[model samples]
Target: MDVQKTEIWDTKMVPRMSQFRAFQQVLDRTHSHWDLKNSNDDHYTAEVRRHTVNDFVFTELAADPLTGNRTISDIRQSDHHYFCLLYLEAGDGVLRQGPNESKAAAGSIALWDSTRPAFFGTHSQFHQFSLLIPHEVALQSLPGIEDLCGLNVDGNEGTGALLLSHLRQLHDTIDTIDTQDRPAILRATVDLMAAAFRPSEEKIGGTAFRRALLTRVQEHIIENLGEPDLGPQNIAAAFCFSPRYLHRLFNQFDMTVSDWIKRSRLFRSRSDMETPYLDGLSITQIAMKNGFKDSSHFSRVFKQEFSMSPRAYRNQAHNLRLS
Candidate 1:
């Protein structure tokens, strides 16, 4: 995606007083309502950069202090059922939905449902990244999402920290990432959020927690596959989980942590080898590229998993393409 084409709205393009109206117009198009508290023309400024990938929408918004609402009346006016996960990059705010209210500070995240009446107010200049997932799509991953509405997840520790870090990275690289990869990245983001919100042992039970943790760990491994030191201990430390606990989480998957990493590396290597664009690359080069320090060990694992050498697999792919 072109970086310049990524921005959908900017206050700089409009006059001072019209800034709020322009922002509202963009919000209307997305089936939401905004009520700007600071009606003073001199004080209003805003910008939104939106990137839509499949059913998810990643938006970066910067603006002066203001209040917004998604009410039952508003919902009737425009019925686009969605769930928003807002991560604050700067400033502070409060969100209220039904009986729950939470304060959101920089590095913190808040979840809100569009089908319910909700209100959020920014108290100062603010910058935020919001991931809008369709209600149906989010429900598929997080069945108990209703229990999380208006809840604030602290992004400084635990799965929340990992979720925040991954979101920031995605926001930073969304434009540069291949169009084919965006959907997978967005799906992973949703999975991480579902995990981040269900931290209570009693609420999600032990099994559910383990599954979410496994998903997060797998995502971390895939993202860092190129790092030679990417292992259970380092990955555990990254998410503030103990090495023993990390291994325990993978037990239910019937695979050890090391086994999963090796499998993932081999899978990626096979994918690259099958690509005609990389056909000219040597097997050893492909092995190292996929984080295999020793080509001999990679070859051993590849043949064990696929019953064929990497070179043989590539040759078969070439022959099939030629035919």
Candidate 2:
């Protein structure tokens, strides 16, 4: 079969009486090598939306129940090898990789590797989000992360909850993010996964632990950016870490915690300023809404960051939209 690079948002729907051949063909192109089978070949229905996000591919699929297998030969035939993180938005399934097997329910996340043979069986019609991460990048982000393959992380509470929320927000606000920030977002995703699946015996001072902590801190800053008290001190207090340690963590990423908060607020404010639905609000209101206490300060920083005043940027964006 010929393979080509997928589009940014490629949507494919199964048609009638093809015996699921088309479904399998598209799946192989968008995903990895797989031999698929379903009880309803004549009437099997599936919709797949594959979206590209920087180095990762985020795919949303809604389909009738099916089972798939990848054997050693299948793996060798596939051109791409990577780690897949799957979130079951609405489905139940079982995934087997190596000697590990996991039962997946709605709101559960599972990790698996494409280099290994695996089997997946779904119990009912379902919706899912599959994130494909490059193999080298995954290993670099969290050494030994492959050990967690075939394990499901419960999305109801603890670190799992935070990871789930981050993924959802990433999807919802993807269009608002700047091109330069996309890499950071991808890195944070890996860190969050490591945090959720790191072994219980891992040391707190480990590299993965530090990266995970940094991700958590960055998320906290994002969630509380609108608060007047959102600064290093308050953030450290919330995380039960010393302010010095927070600074040290950010330093490792070549960023200052306070600067990141300001940058995040600025980026959010800029996105709002460009949106048509927010046109009624003045530039000052937009700045304040994004944690800017002083309009003049906000204007100064906005111009420095984007080489234009917020009002000018909004006007330009509006003109482009009208054109």
Candidate 3:
């Protein structure tokens, strides 16, 4: 099979600098005493004595990939950073604000939002792994996720340990992961990562429900590509989703769900034209039967897509077969 990219920046740094700039942003704020190393083709680390000294280290480590570099305040109120998705492979401490103290250690995941000031201080040396996903991707995995920004993913045991183990595996093997498994791994990471941060039973069930619902929609789309009634409302009602949330899923793919339905239908129609056994069916009849109300519109769209009308496409295929 032709290779798909699953390139790792840690494993390939010379040309990967551009690819890894965004990942580097998560470590922006290391205190002055922290050892520093920045080079084009080198593995870098941002180590510190505690997880909760300050949150400013993130933007400094990042510089500026999406938003401006977050500045370190002289008299910081938050022992933690303003905005971050914090994960630790190993460490221990208590992050404090007012009367609440969030436990920090290995197997822990916590989200800090810059939108609100917060604090979490690791009492001792901390080992950290983190990411600065775009605000858009963040919301995709956790709709209305802003509500849980300051909350810590409880990590004493169970699913939290499972997620922590996965992170450890990812960190250890970031050097050598197969390319084809990359997308699935990334998606699984997003699912488990979100799970680590929220412990509410209701929230977990909700995430699972959405994931299952989307999977079913995908199955329906593939199975009934020719039925035009497969429009947004029917889909939304079938899956018990609001059309708005349905749009969000399509938005992730840079398509309107309706547009994808039409595109899929047209592709299937064109494929049908090439079948010699179906020669008894005229191209116009095939188009009309496969969800096209206006054959002229179908012709225009098909020609624009394939650079030939449906009839020409069939003729070209037929000639190629006889030759």
Candidate 4:
């Protein structure tokens, strides 16, 4: 995306005595109020890289040991509230908000809310990436987000590992992505975060986790729709779950695994039939391209889905375009 980036503050750019003030001013303009503390006055060094991807913001920070707080006064002065997800790349820290508190280490993630009071402290040199997601946008994917505040999600296993891995890759390749693709990428990022923070199976009966896993599975199915062997058993194996459990997961949405795949293939073929450029391909070819081995069966399902044969739908689309 060749994401537009700004080096908001670099202690090396200013005198030693003015470094802290410069850092504070930069924080005031970019983030909410934060009271910063450092042990060594002469050795303090810090740098911040800010990148805006659509409505979300990513800040990469590297600095010496320090402690900071977003006090009650700071929350009162802020205009917009945000939910920040911190991905720790190095060092360790402790975060506290309300009555919740946690000790975070490398490869862990912490959630912070700007609408409430919070405290964060780093015990040594640190490097981390922070994703500042607006409260409204975050609430869309994570309705129970408030429960996640002041907690550290272990990013070394399960869905948390997947989310952190995706974020790290995004950070490394943000420059190569096209601007038009940023919004969708950011949306997926939020989805992963929501999935990672889902409550334990004992608490919510694994409903949220299942939803997240289903979304990932559906995306994988779409990407591999051209493969003739893509089916329920294989899909379950891909995600390291049992075939019976996979079927149960789909049942939550009142769908059978095979039925869902058939519907997806039918929809793709139908859309292609309506496109002018794809008019050159025969009905059998289109069906085969979308994983339907039997053209007659594909036609029957298409009629049932769209209330017309594929050929009729394509011809009607062509006539409409001509008119």
**Residue 291 of model 1: what lDDT?**
88
Q: Candidate 3 deviates by what RMSD?
A: 14.2
**lDDT, each prediction:** 0.79, 0.79, 0.54, 0.80
Cα error, candidate 4, residue 153 (Å): 1.4
Best TM-score among the predictions, by candidate number: 4
List CA RMSD, all candidates: 13.5, 12.8, 14.2, 13.5
Per-candidate TM equals 0.60, 0.60, 0.42, 0.62
Q: Tens-digit lDDT track for model 1 on 108-159?
A: 9899988788888988999988878877567546645776799988899999
Model 1 RMSD, rounded to 1 decimal: 13.5
Candidate 3: where are CA atoms >4 Å away?
Answer: 1-84, 89-101, 114-117, 198-235, 238-323
Error of 2 at 16 (Å): 1.1
Expressed as tens digits, the lDDT of each residue in 35-106 for candidate 3 is 112343333333222122111122112111111222234223223223355676556655433333466666
Model 4 ranges off by over 4 Å:
1-5, 201-323
Best candidate (score: lDDT): 4
Candidate 1 wrongly placed segments (more than 4 Å): 1-7, 39-42, 204-323
* Model 2 per-residue lDDT at 224: 83
